[model samples]
Target: MTGKQHLTGKVEALEGTKILCVGDVMLDRYVYGDVERISPEAPIPVLRVKDERSMLGGAGNVARNLAALGAHVAFASVVGADEVGEEIERMLGNVPHLQASLVVEPLRRSTVKTRFVAMGQQVLRADHETSAALTSAAQTEFIDRVRGLVPDVQVVVLSDYGKGVLTPEVCRAIIDVARAAGVPVVVDPKGRDYSLYRGASVVTPNRKELAEATGENASGDEAIVALARKLIGEAGIDAMIVTRSQEGMSVVMASGEVAHLPAEAREVFDVSGAGDTVISTLAASLAGGLSLVEAASLANTAAGIVVGKVGTAVVYLDELAAKLRENELSSIESKVATLQAAQDVAASWRARGLTVGFTNGCFDLLHPGHVALLAQSRALCDRLIVGLNSDASVSRLKGPTRPVQPDIARATVLASLASVDLVVIFEEDTPENLIRSLRPDVLIKGGDYTVETIVGADFVQSHGGKVAIIDLVPGFSTTKTVEKLSR
Candidate 1:
């Protein structure tokens, strides 16, 4: 199988894979606004507050990413006895398939990093945190909690942000317990001390962190691998995975095995929480029974996805699966076809006694609404054929500025969706011709359209086929999106 296919299968196997994540947890808050002028009181831009949001940060983010990948995560972390800490606990409680063990340290203060963003750019960042190591009593209790949870997990992840949660003692204790339990430990290391991570199965350090930790040149692939091996030998770890931003990732093992996987991200919108995504996916993949190399490869893919999104986002299983399918040439080419090909494919499905469904749209900027419509359409039949309006047709029907993406681009994207079995581009404003040609078993459309208003409803129903009107997801419209972008 191709690498994408292999990784896709590994992602599928991640369901119910138990993971124990122990480390620092914080709340990341973003304050978004518009900056129209300079502040009179200080040398800074004045941000007119508009909106704000928050999400789990640090190791809590790692656990969130693991949960998003369909893993059963046991998250253990320390939080201060404060309102922010309470909010963090409440957020963790809402994540599915996750069991949180948050130790409350009354004397310590919870960490909160707030960034002020204006016009899509961060202007300033303020932090409220305490970096002092946990009290001895609290550390002992934390380690004991982690140790008790290790035996049941298939993998252990130590997410260290240098936030004082993963102290030297805690790190060593958890690593030893995990090693004794035969559960591999994945460490997202912080600071220059590799000794704290001794006995780990793998340590993931970005280029900068690797250089700082080993005090070596991590500029090229050879230099990186050398530094990684040096650290592995020095730290008594089995292997090291170095994340080289745009250059990709390098896997160096003490067994003399090495592989440099290329970066998978197409666009870099935000690198926030990317490391969390990598380590979480790596641990989850390993727990799913993949080899270290296979796990790292999947982690690389997950990192690629998370960076393309805004904020400290987690990569969901469906998003990862869609990305993998989009990367496969055979999958894309087979799904996107001409009208004649779609007709033939529909006929073949019908010949095999399969019900074929048909749906049509400009699908300009495919959003959740479009995805929901297609998925619901697919569920009504064994096969789904999507009639895509060509760019020219879209411009003629909607306007010259319609279809933000070109015809081929739209068709390829539509075909990439697992719900869509075939995508056929049509030059006309309506799919009446295509539907008449294919004579699908079911005709599907969004609920906004009635049977009388639907282009092919009469023809399909007259030909003994049924029409389905699936509810549209509220508050999503490509036209509104385009207008907003224009504004």
Candidate 2:
């Protein structure tokens, strides 16, 4: 199979993939507001608080991402016996398909990072954390929990954030246990010493982390591979996957195999939990029986997707599937997506601060009027999604003889247009459900339909979106053209 096909198949097989994730868990909070003037007490800018949000951080993020990819994640971590730890436990419980084992350390403090932002820029960040290693009792209990869970999983991930969760002894214990069980261990390493993670299946380090760990120049592909090979040998690991921000990722093996994947070009937003996403995707792919190279490539694509979002976000399976299809298939073919995938694509666009536009029709026997409507709709937003009626729906709405083409054929024709970013085939007579799910920023239709007549106009307007009616092209009607041809 082609590489894309292989990766896509692996992604599809990710459902029910079992993985063990062990590392530090923290709470990430964001405080958003407006900065209108300087503070009266100091020269610093004042942030008028507007909104606040929180999510699981550190290894918890990895587990979250794994769950988002449909994996059955066994998450093992340590939390303090405090309110924040209790909150973390509550959040972990809410993550579907995840089994969390958290050891409560009475002497430790749960980590919490709060960032203050104004006008889309972060002004300050405050951290509340305890970096001390877990006490002996807590350590013993944690490792015992992880050991009990290792044999049941296909892969083990060690997410080390230097937050005292993955201590040297704990790392060695888990790695050895996993190795004994024939389950590969993937480590997101921290610190300069590679010896702590010896005998791991693979170690993933970013460009900076690789340089720091190896004490070598990892500036180019060749240098990175060299450093990775050296680290693999010294660290007693099978391979190393080095994540380069814009330069892409490099995978080097002790067996002298190497693959350098270029970065997927995407607008970079908050890169907070991108590493968590990469490791999560990697582990899930491995559990799904993908080769190391294929897993790295899939993880690379996933990293690209997560970085486009505004915060520490997990990449959904639909989003990854959509992006992979976009990468592997022809542009027109890629534009045809399932409703779930289209919804995810629309969400990704919105996360990148782009407005999404929606317009739908039978789109059979393509004509200038349809083209005009699509072009005008495209001009109204950053991305336009065309919801095409299925053959059954079209037959019901316009009679069996009305639609001259099948749904796929008509969708392909619409997708071939530059104005359409996505084409979703809806089985319903109208695109109301599709519109409601996608929740586009603007809803557009032909001038023949008024705002009151539009299917999703009220819903869109209720959500602070717009409704636009583009005038139809004169003398350009699909029914007239079909009649003329018949005559």
Candidate 3:
């Protein structure tokens, strides 16, 4: 079934699902700097540190994603009794309904992946960690704690980064406890052995891991499907999802049913912890009763969103809803603006007690469909905001030599329309982020969209908003107008 048909039931189930994530947790530290001078000893430029920040990594990132997706998430992981552990706690504290329990190992140094970025590019990365297996006593204590939480959760995720917390015994103990309690277990495995994850409900592996463990180079679509099936059988997992960067993912069910999901990413800025996003989303969806197919699809879309971010990040429920809305409007809405301005404009719409219906377009030339859609959009709400593409944004979406009119001219023409209440221009090719910022109460598109096709439909619908398809006016379009003019 399509995403929309399954969405209603799946989302309703999410509110009741509780998830527990336990595994290797790390702190991701970023040191931002500027390279103004070169070092005499080496060819590297000297970096003047400007800022330092830290976020949750590994299993902690999984827990963050689960919480952001509205699951009642409890994280159980080991942290060194140190400052990095304290900072990790502080970050996780900000998430609502998420609780973190730590087993501090005095002897173990907390895992920290610190990267130095200069002008948005990573200059170098430094790691502070230990990959040795936990002591037998520590492993038993961790298992007891996870067992205590297992009975209360509907699903469990074991995020093994090979950072020492997740040993074979720990994985087995988690799986046993979860199975005993009739709860689902999912794993993000590390190292070369697939046998460690035997009996998991699902195991997610990236292309490299899958290739390494299965001894099969699952590069093309057919090979991925084949490998997923083989691994599911060999590892005894109920299902397997192999994450293919840029290409999305392929899910293989225990019954050998293979489903392929395409990546929805328009741009990929950084893909530091996209796997965490996938596993987190899948666990929540499964706990909420989504089928393997439905859950995997949501995971695919969510991962696509996170990779566009700069570092390890979580996908907000509201952001997902906005992405769905934009997908719904792609055929109709055009033009784009900076995310900050888009948010400000969206806030303005919210305060007016008017449901600002938004739809964008290139509007290269004002045409009858544009006027009709704007009028119809205005009819749905007290006001209508037209998101236009700046000349640059348009060139990214449409080709160069396009936008027949500049952004300023297009804005002037759109502003002149009696139906258009406001106009905001965005710079990105897809208005995914812009739609997220504007978060219009009602998203208007042409009749061409289904609930699934609407980019921000999920975001809007999740927030009690509606998406409508307005009929296009006949004999309209910039392309047609251009054709006539050229003739």
Candidate 4:
């Protein structure tokens, strides 16, 4: 495949893959409020706390990110016998498509990072944890869990947070097992000594971590590559990625090839846990069979998104896909047309040996569920055509209060999505006329419907077209959103 097509294909290729993440796990707590006045007794500000949230941190964050990117992650970590540990374990258990093997160390305390924020900015941070190395027994138990996971996982991520969980012995044991299993190991290295991570496939470090590990001043790319190569040599790893915040990230391979990916332009709000985002994206991309450069580029985009978000956030598959499609917007713009224009495009696509899929909806209020449906629909075919119900048809089917957004606006939004190739608006109550005109190779619907019940199903079948049904995302509907607003 061409390089550009290969890179874009990675987004869809990341689904349903399994990744194993092993390292430090922590609970992140955020306290949001407005700091109005100064305290009378002390010199600190008197803040009115408004909201609080807790999320997976450290290695756990990496697992969450992998899950968000559509991978089934096996997370193995060591917690403690505290309530925070209990809470985090319960939370991790609820993460969809993630299996956890959390071993508890009675002598240690669970790691918890508390951040107090005001005006979308962190004011103070507190930590409750231990940095003591694991006992020999605990280390062995943890390594065994990871070794067990290696058989099922396509890639292994050593998400080190400098916590005692990833002590040298644990790192070495996991790497050896993974290497023996023929699984690629991606280490988010911690501490100054890179020797612990020796013989791994790749290591990811930020500018600060890279500089600290090698004591190399990163004034330029050549200097950074020179220093990163030094660490790669000493650690015996295959490659290194040094992430520079605004200047982007660099990939230095052991074979003396260096690649630089410019940072995705984003308005940074908070950079909390962006490093976790990087490693998770890198591992997922590599597991998706992307080249090292493609993986680094995808990781850079993911990190840029996380830094722009409000708090510790993940890069979802749809979000990343949308970002990747932004580069192809110019090509998509040419696909928007009327009935004749859409027919022409479909003929051309068929001539190129492409399978065309068709799905239609009012799409008055675009939500994650809609995006998910479109994404899955596109995955079933080479090209997808979306038939949008015009404003009058939407009002006729969905009532007068329907179509929260106008037809033109809705069409624009639908066209912008990556899963869509061409859009044709129909004035009829159903997309039957449009379907007959388009003659797509496949007809798709997001709802559970039988062939006899779906609109234009017989017509499609009579013309030898296949029908596909993708289930709807639960708890999401335009009517529900409007009702919630009214309430």
Candidate 4 lDDT tens digits, 228-321: 9999888898999999999999999999999988888567766878889999999988899888898888888888767766566677876677
Task: State how far residue 234 of model 4 sits from its true place (Å).
Answer: 1.3
Tens-digit per-residue lDDT, 231-299, candidate 1: 999999999999999999999999999999999998786798999999998998888888889988888
Taking all chains together, each candidate's TM-score versus the true structure is: 0.70, 0.75, 0.68, 0.70
Q: Which stretches of candidate 4 lie over 4 Å from their true place?
A: 1-6, 328-487
- Note the Cα lDDT for every prediction shown: 0.88, 0.89, 0.80, 0.85
Which ranges in model 2 have alpha carbons more than 4 Å from their true place?
1-3, 327-487
Give per-model CA RMSD.
Answer: 14.8, 5.0, 14.4, 15.2
What TM-score would you give candidate 3 relative to the actual structure?
A: 0.68
Location of the lowest summed lDDT over 10 successive residues in candidate 2: 1-10
Q: Candidate 2 at residue 309, lDDT? A: 69
- Please tell me which predicted candidate would have the highest TM-score against the true structure: 2
Worst 10 residues of 1 by lDDT: 344-353
TM-score quality measure for candidate 4:
0.70
Query: Which of the two, 3 or 4, has more TM-score?
Result: 4
- Residue pairs clashing in model 4 are none
Please state the error at residue 481 of candidate 4 in Å: 22
